[model samples]
Target: VLESFGSRGQDLSTEELWQKVLQEVTAEELRAPLHRLCALQAGWWLADRRLGSITSLFCLLRQAEDTGRARCSQGENKLLYLLKAWQVPAEEASLPLVQSAEDLKETLCTSAAFLQGLLELEAENFPTAFSLLKEAAGGFCSKRVLAQIYTCLGCCAQRMGKPQTALQHLKQALQVDFQCLPALSHAAAVYHELRETDAELQALALLYEALEKNPPGATSSNPRFLMQTELLVCTPVLASLLRDRHPSEVKYLLAQRCLQDGRVADAVEHYLDVLTLLQEGPQQQVPLVGSSALPRIPEVFLEAASALEQAGRHQDAITVCEEVISRTTDLIPRMLRVEEELELPECPSPGEGLAGLSQKKENLRCLAWRAAGYLHQGWARAVLGESKEAITQFSRCLGDLLRVQLCGSGVGLTENPLPEVEVLQKIRLLSLIGRGTQFLELGKHKEALLDFQHGLQISPGDPAAISYLVLALWKLDRKKEAAAHWLKISQSPPREDEQVGRSFPLYLMSCLQQAVFPHRESLSSRLQDYL
Candidate 1:
């Protein structure tokens, strides 16, 4: 009788429940019901990122598992689960319980072999591990063997600048074991190299699954393990997104805390900002570890789209939707389309008023990803046009996203892969202001004005929020009153980056085209200079 709690591999946070499952597991319970969480190295060698020697740390854990470091299976299982949650998928994952001492040793050896190679490669000893893993793959070894084989090869190819080829091997690794750390790692790298950022983000979620805990206790005779966290997950590439840089680390840590506190949307925005900082190309104004091979351009594009869509910028949403659709023939395009449609005026409020049940039903295929796609599209659309469509798109995108954000998924779709305090703040601000912006675009000026006002309260001195308030008031025939708010934005710039700065140029250009605002050459020069 295994004494673990909850429903076996159905969840991740099962520490306490696993402790109870040691009572004794039945023969029937030895099959697919047994879920294991193994640890993959969170930190490893790359361009310029380090996390407390995470590679070596995982190696240490492997040693402990092999050498009988823990007396009881409970301790071993807990440690194993933590490791797996961290993204290391073991070959022995689906194996039955060890009935005898030798059986235990056999399992330990199998786990060790895979983990050893993982650590070696992560530690930058690719040549050494590759030779060994290759030798093992020749025999009828575990899927882990094949996973390591192809993944390592893919990584090598990626570093050598053969992205298309690297993608092939990486995909094979994933085929062998979707949750395999090496496979996921290489796949993420390859996707970024190929500019298939949507794929990269999805693969990244698998990395996070390794760290998640299974909830709900399982029924078992022996309480060897617990399954308190019912949300069984794939894995997450946590450390890959963060480097040793202080700002990056801080941002990621902040995002983690926010996620743990049940603020996922906020966390998503934080990471997006961080990703922007990370994606600023090699010649960034702020020095953060931005990689040449990183899919920063696509990632930033997606993040902006999401932010704008959430803020209800229909035109911005359309722009991102087009870009995403144009770039890939993958499922994301279909998903973004659903969001684009939902942004339409006749779609009704989030909870009621729409007759698009069939459309929503169709989107149910991959609601989470679809919701995420819409999130990106809305933000992008907001940037290209007036607030109306963008606002609607942003609202619908978020509504769909929140509707299916799996309780504790800790999901984020942003340029900044790491979430921090600033990211979370931005998320909240964006969510509120995005909704407000939608109202403004829809000609519900009073409603938009109120929403903007509320957003400003949350972010007291946010220049963007102030600008939004001004826009809302102006649309509501309160142009004279809105001037005071513009004073705030002119004096203090919130986001002065190219993306944020584009808003300034765009607004001026719009005014110039329509002759709505007055400004001769000298005045315009002053305006340009001030901006």
Candidate 2:
């Protein structure tokens, strides 16, 4: 009859075979076969699928026990054991007495506590769950059972807002079984909550690997396989969870991970998704858990453009930069109008109103973003060897930045209103460096010297600007000035320790040597040795 239920590849369904067996088998004969069926159903229950068969098997076993079958005691004990583990509302009077002589009594007790803990956890009674699960974990002898127990404890700790303890439990669970999906997933959530992005990604990477290795349909016994298939079956639930949890940030982090791993194309796609979510406005915005603000949209767009440039997609980088520029331009006119209106006699408060102050600061931010866009555009042009066009872009960037500085100065705002002062300074320095390099390439040595001098004034320790200044002075026939600059460069901090790379200095020295004295190999060798 069990073979007819497909135990040995019979064609009949379980329900059909069971009905036929019910007609022929007495309660005594049915107990053994029924126990076998319940064991099979229990495996499905562990995998968290097909509860119907498990429920039916439990009912059949209960019927045999109630009918006073002589040999049904073992089957009755098995049913009680499973009920305790499942946290079913079984009558204590009907529960089979724990046989002290049984070899597996401890295991049965541990399993019961673990399942009851899981039930409490499902009901959101975390403290009780924690206590019960902890006790269960102490009694577990099997590594697999212990791993599950620890994972439940971790879940309880996490719910109780004890992330550190939760992480410890999760780590123990993983140590017991590296492929434990529940532990890995919970670890990822805990690390994310702790703002340990790198650790979160590490856990997620392991989880993904486990999912791939134990794909659904490979086997039903592996819980992860069942979970993976269920996740695919109910994608909307997954989507809802992702939507509520600020998936944009997760996508951004994943993009950063992909970029770090040299998966540039994947990073680009993820970055684009982040930008799309931002552009869709506040309704589409998912509030960051434990954070008050979303990521700055302009900064994200700039980063995306940079990633595109790194992937050698120059045109795409330029397009993104142009979008930033256009967006900033559109806001500038509105901000200027607001500023003008605030200055009008009709507005008694002037800049005292919060709205006015906010608009003013936003104007400054837009100007800074515009300058940044130009700086990025200049870099793209420079990388493509368009020196003249690059010079134009750099000049525009410097002009915009100077205007921003002038506006800040005129506002009687002793401090920089925008929190992007450092960013503005970086863009200014890059503009100077780019323009200086272009001027040197165009043989406008004096102009190059002036740009380099301005850059050095902004950042005295900058090696690239200093090296370029020396070359520019030399080309202009200022021998004394060139020698003094060379001495200064030599006395400056070691180039190796500076943020600028050695290649810039090497290239500058090579160009100077070729342009001034191509035949003076001895002089060039001395310069190389000094470098």
Candidate 3:
């Protein structure tokens, strides 16, 4: 009958089932299956989120402590062990049942202290939790439990704002149980806070490797106990673990950090790994949490493109840009209009439903990302010396930028464009410069001159624009104007923040037909000397 009860569905409450077991099973028979049944029921309650039922069951177990203490059967010990491991609270009553041996008594005391530490941790009483956990660590317990105690102590120290102390406790956790992924995660976070980039990367790499080998939710060898995942899901640390330590998220962080620190090849590799992981698994949305959140998928693709471009894999960069374009183009609106009276909200409005206002905001985001895709593709094509193709791509980028219409006659966008509009201005400047460079490649000096002059209007004294403008004026035989601009470039104190390298004009010259701009190097030298 007890074996049959295992298959019972949730239609019958665990408490009611317990009463039925007591009525049908004799005391001798009950003792055999009692702990097993309780463990099973506790899992069911946890799964259903009926934490109250779990607490009630824990109370019942504490009530039986007096009767079970003298016997100290293996059944009772296993039950107590699992209950504590699951973080099911036993009221501050009699000590949990264990064999009467001195070693067992020490273990029992440790169990009591561990539970109390967890209770204090839950209550956000860090000092008390730390003290209790420290005390618990001195007694005999399973290595898993010892690791958990150290982890809790580390968490307490972290909460108390002692990161160095927290790391020590966390290191002890891993020392006890090398498989303690949570300890590694906390250590990584500490390293990040300390601005130790290499240490943080090392920790993240270890965490990712560990998670891949023994992925979360894997079946445990000890079936009698709940899976570690089942217990962890209920805790606040688990929330942080899921938010900050997910495998794909970890890869993305690795890629982002690599990119920031100028590890272009590594960044591309990590970003590609993240993209592949996302494809094989469910797409992970960027969490809205600040700083630590993963970037949206489109943003990741754009970043990957940047990395690829830096690595001189211009064709691969174009391929990822096309991926972004294909994915987001259908979602973008053909036209996006904003009102002058109503300021554009940077975030979604609570009152505005997703189907209405929020969806509109989403569409705008898609448009901007798609435009970015075009911009990157254009730059890649220009770099590869496909000037005509590059001009077409830049024109497409400009077309997407022009879709945004500011609808109002009065004090309009001219007075103060939105921040998004300001970003669009920068993109527009790049597009003009790129297309102007392409025109120069085709020897259309007049058209190229107009583009460079217009680009200078948008951003005056732009080094790249000024350099190209000098080239265009010389090509049109306006040597006086050309010499004057050449002096401007020489006289202008070198801008450390110049977007274009001093050799950019020389690079542009190499990309064009050498015959059309014959003796360009000699002409440049003569002009510099004449100036």
Best by TM-score: 3
Q: Give the TM-score of candidate 3.
A: 0.62
Decide which is better by lDDT, 1 or 2.
Answer: 2
Tens digits of per-residue lDDT, candidate 3, 1-531, equal: 556645444566658666555555555544534654565555555545455565566556555533443333563334344345332323324545322223323443465456556667778888877887787788666676677678778878988899999999999999999877888888887888888889989998998898788776552535223233224224454345333356788788788778767787898899889888878856444454654546677877887887887778989989998999999877877788755533445676777545665565566667777877888888789879999899899899889978877666532324554445545566667778878878988999999999889878876877677878888898898989999988877788876643332222111221122112334477679797766
Number of colliding residue pairs in model 2:
0
lDDT (tens digit, per residue) of candidate 2 on 416-457 = 222344445656766797788788888998899999899877
TM-score of each prediction: 0.29, 0.50, 0.62
In terms of lDDT, the poorest run of 10 residues in model 2 is 502-511
Cα deviation in Å at residue 101, candidate 3? 16
In model 3, which range of ten residues has the least summed lDDT? 506-515
Could you report the Cα RMSD, in angstroms, for every candidate shown?
A: 20.1, 15.6, 10.4
Name the candidate that leads on lDDT.
Answer: 3
For each candidate, the alpha-carbon lDDT, in order, equals 0.44, 0.60, 0.68
How high is the lDDT of residue 398 in model 1? 48
